[model samples]
Target: MVAQRVAVRPEEIRRHNLSRLLRSIHQHGELTRAELTATMGLNRSTIGALVSDLVALGLVTEYVPSGRDRAGRPSHVVAPRADGPYVLAVDLAVERIVTAAVGLGGTVHERRVTTIEGADRLPRAVVDQLAADAEWLAERLPGSQGPVGVGVSIPGTVRRRDGFVDHAPNLNWRAVPFGELLADRMPRRLDVQVGNDADLGAVAEHQRGAAVGCEHLIYLNGSVGVGGGIIADGGQLHGVGGYAGEIGHMTVNPDGPPCHCGSTGCIETYIGEHALLRAAGVTDQHGPQAIAAVFEAAAAGEQRAVDGVHTVAIWLGRSLANLVNCFNPQVIVVGGSLAEVVRLDRVSVETELDRRAMAAARAGVKVLLPGLDQDSALIGAAELAFGTLLASPDSMVASLTTT
Candidate 1:
């Protein structure tokens, strides 16, 4: 005999429907009540109730269209509330930290960037500085209510279970409980989520940047070092333990110069900022401005700069060839300093790809620059914070009420 079905609770159904409606509006920016009804395939009355609940919770706002002449009565548009809850997004790079306050509908309300110097390189010092920065940003928000949460993007591998930095060679951090450290330093109790910068970059690109609508994509980020993130079948590919996208460490030339990770001939050794600078016989520090100067020189026909970029392109192409054969992504986004180099010398990189990559693997694959550029990881961090609220609208409302 078949088992009896358990009765579904009406409250649970209401919560689920509310979440679905909010998610649709969050994803699509703004939708009229009638449009939401048509898109959600729900009855008009149900859509009205759900939107009303969302507005009551301060998650969305309904406004009549302005400056438009319509043939019939105008339907109200539902959009994320401008004065609603927001989250703090921190992007902790090797040499700098960027903090942003992001609200619903992907609006970045406030942002600050600070460069790290000598003693601040210590992990503890970095955490303290970022904590202070976050506190400052939190105070500037419109309301007194605390942020929904904090989402941090680090340039390293992070453990999924406990938010530890498994390895961050560029930052010289290893096996540090970075998430816990930051949480402890927070001015107030808040939920903190940590993720790899490259992984988050891929998330941003797939959702709102260059890779939008592309299910199979790869994102390669080059700063002081190289990092990678993969998206497969419309989801971020986090392998067991969340350490899958370490493409920078992939051995490209076993006999080449040693990498910061103690690996020889890694992809970063060939395409990273230091590698490019050394190849061009430049001794300036490896920063975004320095890298841009190199590219500008190449654009002006400087022989050393041109040669350095070409060498980088060849190695990068070889690395992309491997990724193409492995993942067969529809698009490959080259972000950060590498994007500048590629923008200046696309032909060299494409020629190498044509020669090295398998025809089947290279077919229909487009290599593009990041649409969001340096902001991709930061935007993704904001998305992470927004996702936490969207996942549990009822709990979020309760939390806000108590605050």
Candidate 2:
């Protein structure tokens, strides 16, 4: 018995190798067998066997390279199957719900955006809308294999163990078992996963967006509220309870306004959508459009708008300075409404960084917008939906096929 435990099983090794190959193709779109061998550090024969297995599983296909070298035969290229597996990606934002069918290889096939009018009535309605949206998108795939799972991006704190929305101040959600609720509404067989919007956005940007190869990065998602998704040493910076990247709640001002999270002078109150509006002296108007209007006014040389934007820029810079000192990220990708803020006032943000951050840390960091644009969270949710499938490609494909 002691001797038996010492040796690893051959089948386990095969599974691990197969998953590695699939993940590579998923991330890089396609690769030749030689390239796979080099990138994965596996032998040529093993790479061929793994590619064949994936081909048989309908997860990937092999194609001859269009251009051939006269010196020798061209290596076959492996790419994800067009009609292969896909997942439902739901982005629950401050003003709208965006849904998409994201397939293998990070391809977004189709999408739908629904605007939210009433926040108070969202609890039951939101889940129903998500369920219907998933089904609706799945129906339109047209000869493609069905979704493997459902990934929802909510603007709040989520419980990883059970997809519970612990708190979503913007959506007015609290203690909701969001995963189970959506799963109950959809097909019982489909796996439903929920995560924080900012966290998912970070994952998307890291996987295919602005900071693709960088191991250390910070993605600040500023919508109705400001939240952060930090990647340290090539992984998420999830704290003890999976709530580490709450940048909005960080104390940016000691004598600042109150935040929805029951804190005074939090970063969110200073840089969030409302913060921009108040600075511009806009009243009885709200959400993204109003915020954009303020920036437009500033662009038009309105004094109030200019001052308001300048004030917000000072705080934004200071908040970024705090992040730079602690995390020392390689790149800071700003998305959502804040992306616009950075576009209009990047110099001011950098000015604060110059004044507040250490010279060494600030020098290496680059501030950029989301590479995937406004769809980072939705794409990240799609990545989440594909997690189980990517873990064990062969077995997961089999289950998906039979079901």
Candidate 3:
């Protein structure tokens, strides 16, 4: 023992480098021992020790069969442990709670959905449903390990510092201590995290779907309400109070319909699901089904349908144009149910961006349809959980070990 070099901040550097190494492995998937050493620029001994520790913690596993080019001898590949730790993602939509169990690799293993009544009891009901769903997922995790954390994606502005809901018009929640309530409702052993739904969706798209490798991005959500999420430098821009991506409330038209936020003519006022239905003169059906029917009719070339969708498209374009001017994101991703229609008519949306967005803002900005489609929010929930584990692995481990 040569006194371990008597380093002052060696452990800090080691932890940071370990995190970087883990991120590299996660981003690249399977990597051999030598490949990791070369990519991370860590000495062989250091890399080997860290890899061994990761394996012991079940964060990584060895892959024997090599799926590489010119593989003569079977070299061992280290990869994220798919069966080691799990993440629970919950998408709390306006009318439903979409819950999914995902492994460390960001693959969804199981899913369930519960409807919300949108009344005063909405919060309690949603919490209860989630608790039940968590239990259900816990029962079928398919491994000896437990869920590392619970990540919730909701349709609102989350106060990042305190994990409270600043305002969720659809949920009628105002300044609610969302994270605290949800955590209290949880089994006390699980680590709980909350995020803006649109932000999480952006993470899903950026990490595992269409926006991969695209750093500056704007993700638009078309559901009961319209929302937006922004990603810069491979991370979400949560703003000063975590209310960064509330583009739906952007003033698209001064004389538009009244929004739930007590403002008139917000973007959501003219292009939200309800607004689209009303614009299309649809009243019989409700929720996403009605919106879907409107899109279907538009696809079939119905005049009213075409007009409704076009109007919505124009409003959406204007809202996005504002975002383009503000952030100048490299790509604009349209997601959710309405994104289906937008994908079918990408030319129109792109044309709007070109026409309204500034020259420089529109230069490299490409309008992309939803990558994961309807599964975006679900997968986003999974990504949310993965992020939680990355932040606090020990708390996550404790949470998983309970029950």
- Candidate 1 lDDT, 4-35, residue by residue in tens: 99999999989888888988887777899989
Query: What TM-score fits each model?
Result: 0.95, 0.95, 0.90
In candidate 2 the C-alpha lDDT for residue 6 amounts to 65
**Global lDDT of each model?**
0.86, 0.89, 0.78
lDDT of 2 by residue, 1-403 (tens): 4656567798999999999999999999899887998999989998998899999998899998878453587888999998888899999887999988888899988888998868523767988787778778878887888888999998999987789988988888889998988889887668999989889999999999999998999999998989999999999998988877999999867788988887899999999989988888887899767887888998898999888888888888999999999999999999998888888889999999899999999999999899999999998898888999999988787776676
Report the backbone clash tally of model 2: 0
Off by over 4 Å in 2: 1-5, 68-71, 119-121
lDDT of 2: 0.89
- The superposed Cα distance between candidate 3 and the true structure at residue 203, in angstroms, equals 2.2
Best candidate (score: lDDT) = 2
Residue range with the least summed lDDT across 10 consecutive positions in model 2: 115-124
